[model samples]
Target: MGRSGLPPGEDIIILLVEDNQGDVRLLEEAFHDASIANTLYIVNDGDEALDFVKQRNEYADVARPDLILLDWKLPTLSGEEVLKEIKSNSSLEQIPVIVLTGSEAQTDIITSYNNQANAYVPKPVDPDEFIDVIRTLENFWLSVVRFPTHTDED
Candidate 1:
């Protein structure tokens, strides 16, 4: 794990946009088991996730997350729509977004990358495999990758 009291430049904030309660709990458990210290924020739907990213309404004080884990299927707005909006906005485009979904459709995979998702991982149905996937994802994002820095302040 990164050092405690990370400088703003090193902070790893994750925004998770998922609607399934069980999956949310599983993700939380996975993070806990991994002993990661970074902050993780959860939103139940894509529209609200977009609002949070845009810093509207209740999200006005929220920090822009370094990474986003988005589900392809969401209420109100789809993840693809949210991804497009984020990539389209100059201020938000550089933030890495990982598509975390159960869909294995080739079209969804291609479209997610086409819409500028940084990565896509199909959700695993098996409990042990899901944990492994989460661990691998954590390792890749928090250890192996260097993400672009955000200079803007809202």
Candidate 2:
């Protein structure tokens, strides 16, 4: 195991469903700076995100992600809709989903929780603070929590 004590057998897969290119860059840089040993997949819209999750078409050979970082305001299927679909699916329900959004509205938070989002974090405006948020997320998910092991058959 590395610093997180996660299983050393493979790198964790993290899927980020975000439409903002700037935010994607920030998240990428932060993960690299934090030295997280994982694979990051990016999807520009909610439709693509769902496609990736369902392993349809181009994503047929893609590995299922261990964690998902979702943004609320998205093009095509809204993030709330995505969350509901994931939570309702028996095959996908076990995976942890963290909402990293700019909206701090109470309604958004409550709706996310009601849909079974594992955690909800508002995006930090400051670049450094955003990095800190990513680091904290990495620490908690990779070190403090135990994730279900996923195999090809899963």
Top candidate (lDDT): 2
RMSD of each: 2.6, 1.7
Clashing pairs in 1: none
Model 1 off-target regions past 4 Å? 1-10, 152-154
Q: How would you encode candidate 2's per-residue C-alpha lDDT over 33-101 as one tens digit per residue?
A: 655578899998889988899899899889898899999999998899999998999889988999999
Q: Which stretches in model 2 have alpha-carbon errors above 4 Å?
A: 1-7
- Judge candidate 2 at residue 15 and give its lDDT: 97
Candidate 1 lDDT over residue span 25-117, tens digit each: 988887766654567899999889998999998998888987899999999999999999999998889888999999999999999999999
TM-score (C-alpha, index-matched) for candidate 1: 0.90
Q: What is the C-alpha local distance difference test score of each model?
A: 0.86, 0.88
What shift in Å separates residue 20 of candidate 2 from its native position after superposition?
0.8
